[model samples]
Target: METWKEPQTIILWIIIVALFVIILLTSIIFLVRTIFKKIIKAKEKEAAIQLDYQKNLLETTIKTQEIERHRIAADIHDGLIGKLTALKMQQEITSKDQKTIDALHESITVARRISHDLSPPLVEFTKLPELIKELLDPWEQHLLITTIFDIRAEINDTEEFKVQITRLIQEIITNTIKHAEATQMYLHLKQTENYMALYISDNGKGYDVAKNSKGLGTKNIETRVQFLKGVYKVKSKIGKGTSNMFLFKN
Candidate 1:
């Protein structure tokens, strides 16, 4: 009864230990992969939430801007323009100097122009395409630049749509002047039965879009496009040119 040792029993015990170790490692690997997948999903959700927040912020900001512009336009009409008109009238009646009267008149006209520009002309009577044309065409007289608006389809626009579209085009032109320094710009619009396409391009000196993506103008464009539920593609590089193409499915 005291002589029960066997080599086969020792080998069997070794095999069982090896199997246990292999099983443990497999379980650990499986657990690690599961944890990694969860982490990735959590990160993706966080990113989506952040993007939503940013979009909301952008909408609020644009609305606030419109209010401020309206307020400023009222001030110009009721305050500054009023005073300037009164001064001009007094000069015309009392002053013998034609030059002084002319100067006051010019000041009044300039103030009115500024107010009109601040509040984009998205009037009830004006269509969006016409408004865009008016907005871009005037720059040719003031700047050393040429702008072309090629409209392939007539677009019926609501006031709200006109406001956002007007702002987007305004910001794009401002950016072109500030960054592109190009002398030529073109805006193309095409509307089909189901979708609409817009293209804006500049022949100016371009910047690295990757590095300049956070600019206010770019952000404004992006926010408006998102509001429109549209998709955009931008191509830009240094010393080359910049182009933005937008597509909207109705």
Candidate 2:
């Protein structure tokens, strides 16, 4: 009887040890999984915070840029415009050449237009389609290139949206005319179910866009798109020309 009791006691101790080991392993596994989940959540939170920071920074920068533009326009109108006017006034005395005087007059007119462009337009009071047409007028007589426009989207009343879209078009066309030397260009703006789409294409000398990825014009366009919470894609080839598409959510 004494030997039987000893063996039973040994069996009970073995069972107890096995149960303890199983509980310990389960706890360890649960602790490892919890820690992994916390790590993943932390990383996701950090990314969200960073994205918010970028959005806020972009908004402030755009507002500051508008203010600077206004100041520059005022300076040009007050100083450069005045000087150009004075030059035209002295045209007769400086030279009797009507051609020179006419040239000076044209310069003054161009300067005034530049100053006006530097200031924000009354987008709320104007037709966006008309404004865009006016913007394209300068390129109409570019004997080198034919410009086409297809506008099917009504203007968004939001001030920021209007200004950014208009400026985007202006800047892109300016880049194309000044750099691309393309023979043809098309500007298309359309509205879809969820957003407005802008498509610009030019047939000209495309560049190594990857090499000059951080170019001023490219950065400016990218920043503007980001400000509007939009996306843009640019495609270009050395001789095949370039096409850029932008989508702005409604």
lDDT of each: 0.79, 0.79
Candidate 1 Cα misplacement greater than 4 A, ranges: 1-52, 143-154, 237-239
Best by TM-score: 2
Q: Let me know the TM-score candidate 1 reaches against the reference structure.
A: 0.71
Q: Estimate the TM-score for candidate 2.
A: 0.81
Show pairs that collide, candidate 2.
none
RMSD to the true structure for each prediction, in A, is 4.4, 3.3
What TM-score, computed on C-alpha atoms, does each candidate reach?
0.71, 0.81
- Over 205-236, each residue of candidate 1 has an lDDT whose tens digit, in order, gives 88887888898778778888888788988998
Model 2 over residues 38-88: C-alpha lDDT tens digits? 999999999999988988898999999988987998898899889877887
Q: Model 1, residue 66: displacement in angstroms?
A: 1.4
lDDT against true structure, model 1: 0.79
Give the worst 10-residue stretch by lDDT in candidate 1.
142-151
